[model samples]
Each structure stands twice: as C-alpha cells, then as structure tokens.
Target chain A: MAAIQGEVSWFCCGTAWGPCGTAGGGACGTCKSGNYQHAWPNTSDACYAITHPDTCGLSMSRRGCGFRHYTTNLCNGARVGTTIADCGPQTDLFCGERTCCGSACGSNRIIDLTPAAFSAIGSLSVGLRPCSVDTV
Target chain B: MPQTLDRRRLLATAALGGVVGATGLGSLAPDAAFAAEAAAIEPGAPDPNFVEGRISKISGHLLLVLGSDTVLHSIRITDGTSIWKLHPTTFDQVAIGDGLYARGVRLPDGTLAADSVWVNIVNLHAHIAAVGRNLLHLDHKGQRIVAHVVQGRSAAVYNGTPAVSDLSLLRVGRHVQVLGAWHPDTNEIDIATVYAAA
Candidate 1:
C-alpha cells in the first residue's frame, strides 16, 4: 500500500478509570491503551462517512480490523508498527491543517494511536506529531 | 546504589506481589497494572492508572485534584516519582491551580501512586499567523495564542531532522505543532519545541 502522510495523535482505551472510562472498546471492539493499535479514518463505509478525509483533498483507502501499518514520527526518526483497531480523528473538523518537517509535510488529521503505540515512537505529552503511515 | 536497588525491588513487588506498603513508593496495588496488561481489554475505555486535572489542594505528598469532568482524585507522590513543570522540577514547585496529567498505579484505597506528573504542559497544533523576535503568533483552533521562545530552551525540528536551537525555518501562514508549558488561565505558552517544514 502507498504511504499516507498526515498528523497523528494518541488516545487511551482500556478498562480504565477517570474520564477515559467511557471510551469503551472503540469501533473495532479490541483496542487497548497498552497495545500497539491505531485508528484509521477509512476502516469502513460508516467510518469513512463520519471522518470524510476526502473533504481535505485526500483519498484514503479502506482497510479493516487488524490490518498492520507502520507509522514514522516526522519530528524524529522514531517509528512503530500498529494494527488497525478503531475508527476516528474526525478529519473534516480540521480541514487544511498541515504540519511538516523539512520537506516532508502532511495535511489534516489522519490517524490516532493507542498510548502504548504512540509513546513508543513519540512522547505522549507532546500530543500531535506529523507522521507517515505505510504498509510494508 | 542501595537506594536504586530498593526502588527497583519495590517496583517489582508492585508488579508481581499486588501490594506494597506506603514507604518510599506510596501505596500502589497490582490490579490496575494487571488490568492494563490483560488481553481482553476494551479500547476507548478510561485508564484506571492515568488522571488529568487541576490541583485543588496539596497536603504534603498527597495532592487533591479536581478533574475536568468534576470528578475528585487523590494522587500520592513519592521519591521515585518524576515531576515536570515547564522543565523537570521537584515536588515543591507543584502549586495549587496548576493543571496536571499523572500516570501511575491506582491503589486499592483509590489514591493514585504517581510514577510521573506533568504540570501545565500543552501540545498545540496551530498556524504561524506571524512571527516576531523571540515570539510567534499562533492561530490554534481559531483562537489566537502567543508562544514565546526561550533563548536557551526553545528548539526546532525540521523534516525529520535532529532538533536545533535555530528557529528561522518557521514560516508565517504555515501550520506547526508546538510542545510547551502553558501559562494557566491565559492564552500564552512557552515554546519548548516547534516542529515545522523548512
């Protein structure tokens, strides 16, 4: 699959306490804050209908549960491999938003990762980072 | 060296033995940690071991927090806990009304035994509306934000490159992400790192 460029952020999901307790199992019903998992905008028709990446001039392919993708943090060279485990990011809300590192830049929000996966490649406190998503 | 070994032993005990006394490690049980590691975990659930809120009161090593959701929390700090306020700091620097995010092991008594705490940290995604000497005017989610570049501490990372002190690559009208320490109750932040395209 071709590489997709965009911003990546982290979210927590699991049997948790506090405000995160209501997030449940996400769209795929299998995400965990401790696992190497991520949320893709186009996991299904229903998911795509909500995220609407096309509104931002990007055409994202549809991939379903458990598909693996490697994400690289553009701010640093850090990378992590994660499997699709949810639907999210609500891309249309931040249309035209862009981030870049040197010559590599991506527009809009495209992916969200579980805390364990994100903290592996980037600091959880940093929140958002430009990223490249690939399947190799 | 002995202190380090004792800390390690306490952490191991917290992981395996399910309970540890309130000594140098605070009161932490293994149930929250084990639940996080369980395979039948649900995504989007609240993390039992993580809490975010504003400090409403502080009593010795115990901090009383009021979460954004109006939930009350008790967080216990220990010698092993790492604290960051703008930069790394000691527990005494943590003040009332400061926003914080804590990750730790939740004890059976519901007090969080914090392993780390970040005070007043913010990660913002914004457009560089303008730039001035030692400052950047940001448009974040339709709100104006003023980000100050500390002479010695501010840095920039461009195009997957290593961070450097030079921030000349930041361009007006371009989108950038900023990691900084926010000034609570204000529209300002102190820039730590700005990630931009050159």
Candidate 2:
C-alpha cells in the first residue's frame, strides 16, 4: 500500500465523526460532501467558494477572471479563480524568477512565471507553464 | 466543451494535481513584464446544471435557439416555477427575439422537461442585446434574440471585490453574462450570474 505522508487523510475527519487534529492534520472543520470547512465553527456562513477571495493568498481574486496575482493557479480550472499574488513578493530569495518547484511533478523545480490560483500552505509550488511564455 | 489554449493555464493546473501547493499571486508579478495577455479571463457565471445559451431565431412563439453544438432547437416557452403555480401565467406570454433564459431536465425520451415547463421571461442579457422597450432583442450569428429587461440603478454586486466599481454600463446586445441555477421539477431556470460584456 502507498503509505500517505504524515497526517494526511482524505477522509474528511481522518477519523469517524470526530474533528481532525495534528493526528489527521486536517484544516477543514466539516468533512461532508456538501460541507467544506476547517475545524467546524458555529458560524452559519455557507461554504465559501474554494477559490474565494480570501483563498487567493495574495491580491488575486477568485472572480474567475484571468486575475493573476502570484502568477499561478490551481490544478484544474476548478481552482482557477484563485490568485497567487503573495507568492511574488517572496520570489526574490527562491529564484530571480520563481524557478523552484515545491512538490507535485518532479519534472522541473520553479514557481510558475505567470500568475495562478492555487492554495499554498507554506512553500511555493512549481510546474504550471502558460501556453506560450518566452521563458517556458 | 470550450477548447483551452492550453499553455500557462495547463502548466499551472498540472502543478496543482501533483501537489497541493498553489502559488501566491504576488510572486508572478515579476514575470508580468513579459507574461502574455493573462488578465485572468473571468469564467462564465456559476452554472448549476449548465443549461442556457444565446438565441438565434424567433418566429412568433416558436423560437429557434442555439443549443449544444450550435444546433438550432425549436423551443417552446413558458414561465416561472412557483409552487402555487402563479409564476406560470407570466411565462406563457413569451414572444420572439427575447433574450430568454430557461432550466429543465433531460428526460428518457430525449426531450427536456417535456412533461412540465417553468421559466422566467422577464429579461436577460438586455444590456448586451441592444434591445429597445419593445422587449429585449439582439442578433447573434444571424439570429435574433429578445431578452427580459432587468433594470435597476448600477448596484455594486460582488464581482471580484468591493472596489471593482459601478456596473451601470451593462446594456442590451453587448454580450451579457448570467449565473444561477435550474430546476427540472418545475423546468425552471433562475438567473444568478448576470453581467454584460463588451
């Protein structure tokens, strides 16, 4: 069996009917199909779009327009509306041009040149290349 | 499905599946010096069940619509999905060249919401359709469409931010956009994402 890395559980709660903690390492509160949250709170707010404005992590907005903040986006268009704007300011130390790949595909290691909309936890991820960029 | 140009969008997407890391929007700014026209094209309005299209023809109540693959489908019109059935009255009065919107279900017989029908013919895409008070209307690919008019003062609706500014410029015959849901039981479509394009 392919052992998952530390504290990774696709099963919403990591445990049955329980809140995930460091054991499950889940940020979501509720783990149901229609329920999307981290550490279920008492707020009545509905599930914010996964590509919500707050999820941008940068100035980018999830308006789904070609809004590029960090110059990267999510895997599929599902997360397309997110922004990677914050990733740019931190690019100076990584590479003159975010050429460092975090995980995902081992192909190349570098932050995408163009802005994208993916969720970043700690480090910047690399792999996305626009259709036609002079660098790519 | 609309074909993707498949460049940056694809690469970014590729990175996502391999790892959960998404780049912050700021880092890519440096490359913006040379990045092509990646203005982050907004997606069409949120589509529930994804059923709505531009109109092509209208001869009286028998309107010809550009459906999947741009095939002209002879559409019969109706209106509203009220439980008390009060919405039905407005729907039956539909006319030609109206930039109409609808929602229904695909039945086993290959017909859509055939047994029942529900719709809202007030007005759609009126800003982009270049319609007059005679009922919203516009022409697309040699097809004419009349839409419902949803007139109101330019309100600050959520687009991307609270600073995105006023949207009072929306007009008819100007490539409008809308997002919302559809119901098969009443065969009705409710507008949600409604915006006019240049």
Candidate 3:
C-alpha cells in the first residue's frame, strides 16, 4: 500500500462524555481520549464485519491494536501519528460521502481518530476531512 | 499467537520502507510522502455524530460551545454522559474555556445529545528543544509548547517499541510526537506519552 486515501473523522472513548460512555474504550480496550489513537476499519474479523470498508471499494489491511499509522490532513498539510485503538468509521453507512481540503479530497470514511489525534491536524468541528493514512 | 503477532510487527515495520520506498518518491520527507499519497473524496458531507469546541457557557446541563472553526454548538449532557478532564471525571469537573470533543446523537432541534466528552486532550508533533527537571520544551510547528512529565503516568516509546516509563532515553533536539492533556488556553500540556525514534 503506497498510502491509503480516505475521509477522516473523530470519535470519543475511554470513559468520557455521554453516548461515548458505552463505547467501552473500543475493541482493544486501550483507547483513551487523551491518547494519540485512532479507529481502523480492519482491526479484526468482528471489526471488519462492523465497518466493512470493502463494501465501499476501499481495501484496508488488518492492522490490529497498537499498530502505528500516520494520518495526514490533506486540507492543511498537517499530520499526526496514531496507533490502532479500536475499530470504526462504519464505512458502509457513509459509502459515497466525501471530505475535501483545497484541491485534495478523499472519499468514503475509512479512519476515525481520537479527539487528541484529530485536533492535532485540523479542527474537529470540521468533522470530516480528506486524509492519507500510511504505516510509519 | 505470539509468532503471528511477531510476523505482523515485522511486516508493518518492513512496510514502512517497502511500500514507502516503492512510491519512487524516496527523497521526500516522511510527511511529504504521506501527503503525496493524497486522494480526494466526496466533499461537504458533515459528520452528524460528533462536535468539538470550547465551552463558552454552561447553562444547566447544556453546554454552549464555540468550535475551533467558530461554529457554535449546543451540547446536552445527561447522567449517562461520560466526561474526562485529566482522567475519567464528572461533568462538575467541566469549566468554561475548557476544550471539548463530544460524540453522540444529534437532535432534530439542532443540539448534540452528547454521550461522551473529552476535555483539553491534544496530540502534537514537536522537536525536543530542551529538557528540564520534569518538563520537556517542545517546538511544535515553529511554536513552543511546554510539556510536563507526570510520574507513573508519562511514558515513552522508542522507535516503534512498546511504551515504558523512562525519560532517560529522550535526547534534546529529537523529533517526537506527544499525546497529552492540554492545560486549556495555554502553551502547556501534561504529557501522557512521547513517541520518538530510538
């Protein structure tokens, strides 16, 4: 994989806030909102069954817990390094949805960062941004 | 299982050079190589499940916040909502000016019914400009940031190694990534982990 391009969003975990209360620190049980972490669609079989990025024409490798990946915000040229903390993005639900920055754009939600990781590159309120993910 | 895990780690580490080198863009900085791999997707589709910003006001259980992009959001909290400041804390620990990232259901009335909120958490890439007794002077994108190392809490990962609580290996002027809790409206952070090249 040269670099996987896709839409990036943020998620909450590790006993903070509501709705996220039951997120249960992700599938890895090591996810913390204060940590540099992200949710990859293909952490495990059960995770793949839930996110299914393949349904959206995106093929992600099974990078399990603590696997390192660098995510760059195409819009601002900002990048952050994070470890796989859980499984996520529910790719099929937002199949055709796109996120862009300047002339750079990525389609289909393939990655979700923790608040700490996402804010390091771009503002979280933007919700979705075009990004590239690569193992570092 | 251990052998399988070891193989995966080897592959992942090798991929760092293998796939990245295959791009024919070896001269590029690691960050630049990552950027060059950019591909565009569908644009302007908002994420309906999340919100981020600073708490401008606390009205009962509702929090009025101003997003980093200047958008205003009204977030509703309940007993079920989990709030974290430095750790797993209660809503009473929240204060005005505290930065928050919330994930939950968006109400028809345009409010976000938050289920979880993290306060003042930050991930930063910086150069270790200097080191003091228990502090790391970091240079983040040309800006200086002070990071405090907490005993029993602060950890470091050398190269791609597992994390350990030892700052003795950190050298000055090395590029590192820091994950920590922000002190809110300041240039300081409480370090949780520092990732560095061995």
* Interface RMSD of the candidates, in order: 9.4, 20.7, 16.7
lDDT for model 2: 0.25
Instruction: Report the Cα lDDT for residue B109, model 2.
Output: 33
1 versus 2: better DockQ goes to: 1
Question: Worst ten-residue run, lDDT, model 3 chain B?
Answer: B36-45
The segments of candidate 2 whose C-alpha lies over 4 angstroms from its true place after superposition are A1-136, B1-63, B74-89, B92-95, B98-101, B114-153, B158-198
Cα shift from native, residue A64, model 3 (Å): 28
Model 1's DockQ score: 0.12
CAPRI band for model 1 = incorrect
lDDT tens readout by residue for model 2, B46-73:
2121122334665543346554234345
Query: How large is the interface RMSD of candidate 2?
Result: 20.7
For the second chain of model 2, what is the TM-score against the true structure's chain B?
0.28
Interface RMSD in angstroms for candidate 3 = 16.7
Error of 1 at B136 (Å): 1.0
Error of 3 at A49 (Å): 37
lDDT by residue (tens digit), candidate 2, A1-136: 1211110001112221101111232222212111111221111223122212233222221121122222222122122222111111111111111112223211111222211111111111111222110111
* TM-score: the better of candidates 2 and 3: 3
Give the Cα-based TM-score of candidate 2 against the true structure.
Answer: 0.24
Per-residue lDDT tens digits of candidate 1, residues A34-128?
A: 56789899999999998899988988889899888887777665667778888977776567666665665767788988766665455555556
